[model samples]
Target: MAFSPLLDELVESLRCLPGVGQKTAQRMAFHLLERGRSGGTRLSQALSNAMDGVRRCDNCQNFADSEICGICVKPERRNGTLCVVESPSDLLAIEQAGDYRGGYFVLMGHLSPIDGIGPEEIGIERLLSRVKSEGVSELILATNPTVEGEATAHYIADRLADREILITRLAHGIPVGGELGYVDGFTLTHAFRGRKPLTD
Candidate 1:
């Protein structure tokens, strides 16, 4: 069996999403065409609007409809601390965690030599400039715990070593509720290295 050309194209377009495979795309296309045409129209309109209007914030490199993101514009967020993350998703996760109240610099990606991404590609210079100009006292390297993420953090730290700011990396370890027996060796090592004393 074959779908009409337009329907097939819709299914193919949906397949471009991260986890939507052929069957999932087909199901979605059928659902939209069968009983969700209005919802699909709204979705299409929203996607078009976002694609056309959204751009990276000048200050943090996060997606924004204006020059700067909402987080960057908040006066209280400028608390002499800057958290560097690899993507907008990472920033959103931290925001959702509800503990951090400082500004952020989204790298958009980590340093990957094979992918040809370098310091300039990830806006390290802009990050450094922001640190210096904003009088940031604590620079938090909140990048992912991958090898490339570690390298990127180290690179940024080395670049800022001459400055007076205090730099720190996010601790990588087992989750609060995780069982030690189920934890991997790498995570165990990190947990041990980052362990803190419970008593003075």
Candidate 2:
């Protein structure tokens, strides 16, 4: 029995998502098919809409419909504190915690020379400019607890030494080598509350 070209293409395309394998993609495709056209159409619409409208926020690099994300544009969040994160999802996690009331600088990724990702690739220069221009009073390095995240935080801290801003990192509650996006809201809030300054 041969799978139809449509199903094969669907499975292949779906497999492109992170952590999704061929079996999962096939199951999802079948589920959508079984659920009928409404489900499929809704899924397709959601995918297309998100892909088409989602763009990096000009201020914080978070996903946004406009040039700046809601967080960046918020009047209350215009304070001089900036939370630096590796991804938009991490930013969302922190937002969900409802602990941070300042702005953010989304790195988009960490420094990975072996994988060809570098400071510029992760928008470090842009972040530096934002730090300076935005009158940032403090920089909170909210990257994950991985080696790459540590390296990135260290690099940014070193580079920003000339600036007269306080630099802090999330507290130890996030767990070693754990990703910020997966951490629960309560833990994330606790981490933010108990954040420690990153000293030399």
Candidate 3:
């Protein structure tokens, strides 16, 4: 027998998540109904609250509940060095790495002409203004190593070429434990392009 309208709607809604197919959504709907109705209700409320409360930070463009994110407000963070990333998730990853204590400016997205995303949409002007006004002297580009990422990095570099600020990109290569045989052609090319000389 077919599910009721509510159950069918639940399954269909669940399929909106990435990688969630019809069967998986149906299973999720059944699990939520049978074993975790209260948890499901709590999840729904939490989602609603988060959707309503979350806002992009004014300083760094990261997701936060307030005008600025915690990292941007922290006095301990390096202010003169700004790390530019493609998304808040990338900023989180860098934070998780526990090495970068500098400030961040999230592009939120790359410049994709075909996709209709442009420089203004990604807040490039805001970032440039911040660099000019906030005593920022360096920009570390932490964009992903992809075609769009490269284009975005290049665009920013060209724009800031006349400025006195220094600009650098994240190193792209195979992981520490990854072998050359397993590394792909694009990664190998990057590794070669960014090769460093060994200390004698």
Candidate number of the best lDDT: 1
TM-score of each: 0.95, 0.81, 0.93
lDDT of 3 by residue, 1-200 (tens): 17499998898889888999999998998899999999999999998999999999999899999998898889867569999999988998899989888899999999999999999999999999998898888899889888999899999999999899989998888889999999999899989998888973
lDDT, candidate 2, at 91: 87
- lDDT by residue for model 2 (1-200), tens: 17489888988999989999988998988988887669889889999999999999987788899998888888889788889999988988998989889998899999999999999898999999988888889999999978999999999999999878999997766877999999988778888987878982
lDDT digits (tens) for residues 1-200 of candidate 1: 27499998998899889999999999999999999999999999999999999999999999999999999999999999999999998999999999999999999999998999999999999999999999999999999988999999999999999999999998889998999999999999999998899994
Q: Among all windows of ten consecutive residues in candidate 2, which has the lowest summed lDDT?
A: 1-10
Ten contiguous residues minimizing lDDT sum, candidate 1:
1-10
Query: Any idea what lDDT model 3 has?
Result: 0.91
Each candidate: RMSD: 1.3, 6.5, 1.7
C-alpha displacement of 56 in model 1, angstroms? 0.2
Ranking by TM-score: 1, 3, 2
Candidate structures ordered by lDDT, highest first:
1, 3, 2
lDDT of 1 at 111: 97
